[model samples]
Every structure is written in structure tokens, then in C-alpha cells.
Target: MVELSGKSDPFQHSFPNAVFYIPALIVVSAVAFFGYKLYKSLTEKDRKREEKLKAKQAKKKK
Candidate 1:
């Protein structure tokens, strides 16, 4: 016959550890998202500057 212990399942102990990591994961994700956005914004700004410079040069050539 198989024996079953009355104590809580071993898996239950890991639940708290899992929960504890949730906040850390969320914080890391948020930082990564913000960092990506900042990088994108900077890249866009640089592109716009390049376009402006090209336009100015074109005007001078005319």
C-alpha cells in the first residue's frame, strides 16, 4: 500500500519563493522597457537631426 503524509505538499514551500521573485521580475521588466524606449527616442532624434542637415545641404546646393 502507498503511504501519504499529512504534512503539506513540498511544492507549497516553493510558492513563496516564486511569489518573492515576481516583484523583482516586474522591476527588471519595467527598467528594460523604459531603457528601450529611451534608446528609441534618442535614435529618432538623431535621425531627425540627420534629415535636417541633409535638407539644409540640399537647399545650399540649389
Candidate 2:
């Protein structure tokens, strides 16, 4: 084994650009989750409105 060793790299302590991607990924995931929730709520509202309309028509027929 070689006994003589040089100094370690100076850039080892400096963070790379890839570290910034972690926060970006979290933000994207949060946006997607909220968007999905919005879509689900809108669809539920439409479904309830349709049900009310159908019940009104049925009552009129009877």
C-alpha cells in the first residue's frame, strides 16, 4: 500500500447545483397534490348539482 497521501479535494465541502433540486421537487409535488384536490372538489360539486336536478324532475313527473 502507498503511504504517501496528498491533501483532500477542496470542493468536497461545497454543495453542487443538484442540491437545489430537492426543494424544487417538493414544490412540484405539493402543487400537483393541491391541483388534484381542486379537480376532485369541482367534480363532486357538479355531481351533487346533477343529482338535485334529476330529483326535481322526478318529483314533477310524480
Candidate 3:
């Protein structure tokens, strides 16, 4: 490999290019986890509501 005197890269000693990778990955994963949890909670509430409505209807029919 041809080495340039002032060239910067991820493995270069002068500048750290890959430094932001880990923090960015962590932030994205955190957001995804919270989003998934919110979705699951919302769906669960809907499911419970539907179950209650069905039970109520059954009681009315009886």
C-alpha cells in the first residue's frame, strides 16, 4: 500500500474515523428497542379491549 504523508483513514494514527460507529449503533438500537416495546404495549391493550368487548357481548346474549 502506498502511504501518503498526511492521509487520514480509520487505521490512521492522526484521525480516528471509526470512533462514531459504536455510539451511533447504540443510539439506533436503543430507539429500536423502545419503539418495539411501545408497539407491543399498544397491541396488547387493543387485544385486551377486544377480549373484554367479546365477553361483554357474550354476557348480553345469555
Candidate 4:
């Protein structure tokens, strides 16, 4: 006689091991996006400052 009450199947109630990878991937992608945005903003600010300085120098030469 097979006993159904005492034995439990390992595959029937198993939790997924790779479930946390999804959130980790999302966090890493967000950090990369923010870092790229910061770099772009800083580069744009520096470029604008350079243009202003050049304009000032040209005015001084006039």
C-alpha cells in the first residue's frame, strides 16, 4: 500500500532559486541609466561654460 500522508514530493512545493535575479537586474539597470544621465548633464554644463568664456574673450579682444 502506498502511503500518501507521510511522504512529500520535493518537486511539488519547491521555491524558485532564481527569483531574486529579476529585481537585481532592475536595480543595476537603473543605476547605469542614472549614471549616464549625470555624465551627460555635467558634460553639457561644461560645454556651455566654455562657450561663455569664449564669448567673453572675444568681447575683450574687440
User: What are the lDDT figures for the candidates, one per model?
Assistant: 0.81, 0.83, 0.82, 0.81
Report the C-alpha lDDT of model 2 over 10-62, residue by residue, as the tens digit.
43344556677889999999999999999999999999999999999999999
TM-score between model 3 and native: 0.74
Q: Write the per-residue lDDT of candidate 1 for residues 1-62, one digit (tens) a residue.
A: 22244356663222446665789999999999999999999999999999999999999999
Q: List the residue pairs that clash in candidate 4.
A: none
Q: For candidate 3, lDDT tens digit of each residue in 1-62?
A: 33434555656444354566778999999999999999999999999999999999999999
Compared with the true structure, the alpha-carbon lDDT of candidate 4 equals: 0.81
Which scores better on TM-score, 2 or 4?
A: 2
- The prediction achieving the highest lDDT against the true structure is 2
TM value for model 2: 0.72
- Pairs that collide in candidate 3 are none
lDDT per residue, candidate 4, 1-62, as tens digits? 22334346553443354566778899999999999999999999999999999999999999
With candidate 4 superimposed using the best TM-score fit, by how many Å does residue 32's alpha carbon deviate from the native?
A: 0.3
TM-score of every model? 0.72, 0.72, 0.74, 0.70
Better of 3 and 4 by lDDT: 3
Better of 1 and 3 by lDDT: 3
Residue 9 lDDT in candidate 1: 64
What lDDT is obtained when candidate 2 is compared to the true structure? 0.83
Highest TM-score, which number? 3
